[model samples]
Target chain A: MVASSTARTGAGGQTLVVDLAYPPDPGRAPFTRADLVVTGVDHSGTSYEVRLYLDNPGADIDTPRDPEAGYAGRYTVFGHGGCYGDEGHCEVPEAAGDPTDVRPVHQLTPLDTFVTVTDALRRVLDRDGRLSTVTMVPVSLTPRRSDRSPAPELLEFADLSLHTYLAATDLDVPTPG
Target chain B: MGVRRSAASLSVAELTDLRDAFTALYGISDDRGYAFLAGVHGLPLPQYCKHGSILFLPWHRAYLYFMERAMIDALRRSRDDPAAAVSLPWWDWSSAAAHADGGGLPPGWLAPADGGANALASGPMTLGDADLEQVRTNLPGAVTDGADPVTVRDPDTPDQLPKATTVNRALSATSFTEFSQIVEGIHNGVHGWVGGAMSAVPIAAYDPIFWSHHAMIDRLWYLWQLSPQGADPSAALLDTALPPWPMTVRQTLSVPNLGYDYAAQVVG
Candidate 1:
């Protein structure tokens, strides 16, 4: 499903600030891993990076990329720059109209990106049982030569959600045969 | 069929063969040349390599196969022993050996050769007029500044590499889509962690280490396929063609059928 949220980047790039509601159930055991599940990332434009931080909204390209500064992690998008084909050629393919139809999805279809912020998440939780926010700063890279006059949209995505997983139980690990 | 061993397991003789193979390919500036093959992934007009897509795994599998065959052929032509060529060695980033230093890159990958430059560490990039023009116009200032452009790497600390738990988490995924997304996300992190040209798609392949890093990703997928919970992509997706290569997704499913297999594929 396509997410509705999208962030269009500007000259210095746009920073996405999200207020997170997490720690679903206090009764459950602590999470072993925390992943920032970014869904439906739009990479049809220039390649770029999105730096993730726990609570540092002011984080930018110059910000110290370390755990002490709330730096969680980052991921890069090797984009297509822009469609080089005829009109509609680069458009994301719509779902097959008929279930009987048998064709693979388009190669340019939007995909999900995940960044594991386990250490960062744990630090926030340990300090104040409840974690509150996440900051994602988008940094734009070079665009297609023809469209270089004005900066192009560098970042766009469908959704942002926090997914936490519990530690593996004894049953999950297999015993030696 | 030859077995692709981990970079850490390669013998001194095997390392010499790989270095020789790459050195031979470096001279040839044609389609079979290292620069040309690297360009097929990104840079110039068409970047055929699949990223952030379902075809990511299969496409790279085919690309690796193509490059290995080219390397083998080059070795056969250059040396007296036709068997001198060795299967490409993969950098097993998830192993303890890789986590030993601040950065896990194999010594051979970054080590100098003899008293000269190391082909594996870096190589010259010879882009055609058209490719060079594209770089100048669109990808300004991306290449290294020097008399000649060469592939470069600015890697991050070992802590930045994906942890073993993250890889195991990806392997536990039941569906191909979920598996692809998680693995690709990990793949993207490595690229970013490597930094410099490796971080960018346009010139990433030019770096020789790009091959080993990718082999690790491909190996993980192979392990996943062997797991009981693993399943192939949907029928329609399997039948789809991976562009720029004749092979389909179904064709890339079997590693042995492709004439190679990983030496140690025991999943953690």
Candidate 2:
């Protein structure tokens, strides 16, 4: 995977974005798993700038758990966590744009999807200029719990931040060839 | 290269060997030694744990292989037989889930600690107390990351156990991603079911059942690999290196490459 580094500077703040292009693996569809676009990265050497979690789907290795449960407004309690809905209906990364623009990945691989820090996190960029933490929500999810029937967060996640394996490495930084 | 058998199917001797081997490994304190085996799944940096990604099956397969190798070696030592026939066993929770009283907990795990080394109880944990903690070895020197490392297992945490039928459904998936979603979903359900120390993600490996549970999950994947419908990653996904993992997804697909098969599946 060859990548190029680019930082987007805006009035709000600076987002270190990396574009990663993976070579064709074999008989897979062309570009089906092509470029990985990561935004809101810290890009500073050492420490993690970005973290990716798969919610209940991609929790971690060795430990497998109940997917339907959560705790608190969003605290992961017992088998389940905070949400009162199902992770199945949540369309993340895509819905990242706005509440209504969310689209589900369906049975497709998440390779084409873009992952970014959803909102401004005070701790996102450390004093050293590296990303501190990132929390992702399905595009339609509001930090405040929704009282509707189709709430994706109702069953999607309490916290997925711990699922990533690439922490403490430059893997999140897409270096340009 | 030994076959992994179901715990219920193991003869008295085989079970004893497994218990002894685990006890031996559990007693070791060195990070690079036996503790390292379990720590691979726990702290000292849970670097190779691949969750929420395509490498889920492969990474655990490799990690299981290493731990199983350690078990086999330890078992051989326990029996003092250079050629001792010992292998790690798996818990068929999917089948157990079907039983009226199966999914609660394996009786073997809760066996009364009548002056015997209890594997499930974490009695006198030799790996730096019960925490199974570690310092960062990836860097030049070990340092505290100040991460919370604890283990918990609550029997009632899981809402539903993965039935054999559910696993069969996963096997029925036509795509690798589809199969993983269902299979891994069931996998997550069980982890939550065995709450307590098991509920904690980073330190769950400290529980004895964690290994057996994963064996079942790996066996399911192996079963899928044997089927004609089994899907392998295409070139598009092949190059996606499972970071912190030494191997690729394509490399971990073949069970034979790792040198093991399910005991029950082999017909001679």
Candidate 3:
């Protein structure tokens, strides 16, 4: 992955880095998928998991316990962070035992995987001749409970990156002049 | 490019009036409420899927597009009705009046009402999770079952709640903070760079109006950025990425990808 710093603060402040990975060329058949990986080092060794989620029909990306089974529809895995006790379904079983799961941590997903999913979605949309936009969000993980209040400190490591792409067929149509 | 139109020319009272009038004309209730909404917006009938979910941002933009169209249509009908006194109004929640007390809840939008804790109830009243469930269980046919489809239930009457009451109650009470809070709360209240993966499903399954809510939230951020106490104006709160993801400020501002444009005045 190619990385560049876009936003920087003082020495003590955190810096926002932009990673530009190779795009999937429609001319080519399928290509190797790339993952957007963020690694965070705390007292413990680096710990992370790669996650991908569907952006449509917004719902919880992680499956819930029996009590929350009713709300399974609203799931999306856009960013990575510390593992929670109930995040059992989304958790990499080996990493769940770590107490640091509650602390700041990074979640990684190969970039190519995301593109592939998005590309498939685009093809479906293309077949239907529909114009739509999908937002691909990238977030960094830190050791923190998903339920805790949002703080600048916690936000220090998290960033929201958005990507916009058009299907090859979508490009051929004329946009309003 | 032509000069952008200003949303400032619109007023919240007018929007509320238009919404109410439309509700009255179409008979806003659970069974036909969504259809009325679709009709007013001039949308083709929705082709829904049992397992597919509404895509975020785009879906909402479509909703808002129809809403705007509905408002315009309402305005034209009112011109002929003469009896109708409604007009479109924009809710500028960012105004000082909205945040006078510092809490996020805007005044006058909803009033607290008492009901059994476990039942799903609806109307211009506040009900706990129980009432919410009741409303959910009885949603009209147009409403689809999804991962987090909003629900309502009333424990007291259990069987007697009107569909309209439940839907209106849900629409009025649901907000962005509530959705975000639920997600965070479910995850044990931790905050950090958990990434967009977590938000995807909720956002997708989220009502099409979710985009308008986010647009409103984005508008708040814009307004907050202008405040003296706001975070650094130069700070980039949104991550930048290349297509099929956009990375630059200019790219981020494009409406085609976002699905809708803020009334220029709202941005100001």
Q: How many residue pairs clash in each candidate?
A: 0, 40, 90
Cα lDDT tens digits for candidate 2, B117-169: 45654422233522333222211111123343223344642224555555665
Question: Over the stretch B11-48, how does candidate 1's per-residue lDDT look in tens digits?
Answer: 88888888888888887788888878888887654668
In the range A1-177, model 3's lDDT, one tens digit per residue, is 223234322112321223322232333233222213222311111112222222221212232211112110111122322221133423323345776555212122211111123343334334433312222222223222232221223222333232343333211211100
Candidate 1 vs candidate 3: the TM-score winner is: 1
What is the Cα-based TM-score of model 3?
0.29
lDDT (Cα, 0-100) at A143 in candidate 1? 28
- What TM-score is obtained by chain A of candidate 1? 0.76
lDDT (0-100) at residue B6 of candidate 3? 25
Give model 2's docking category. Answer: incorrect
- Model 2, runs deviating above 4 Å: A1-177, B31-34, B96-98, B113-116, B120-152, B157-159, B239-246, B265-268
Best by lDDT: 1
User: Which candidate, 2 or 3, would have the higher TM-score against the true structure?
Assistant: 2
After superposition, candidate 1 runs with Cα above 4 Å error:
A1-14, A20-35, A44-48, A53-74, A79-110, A115-132, A139-153, A162-177, B111-115, B136-142, B146-148, B265-268
For candidate 1, the per-residue lDDT at B93 reads 72
Between candidates 1 and 2, the lDDT winner: 1
Ranking by lDDT: 1, 2, 3
- Give candidate 1's iRMS in Å, 1 decimal: 7.9
Question: B227 in model 3: Cα distance from truth in Å?
Answer: 19
How well does candidate 2 reproduce the true complex, by DockQ? 0.04
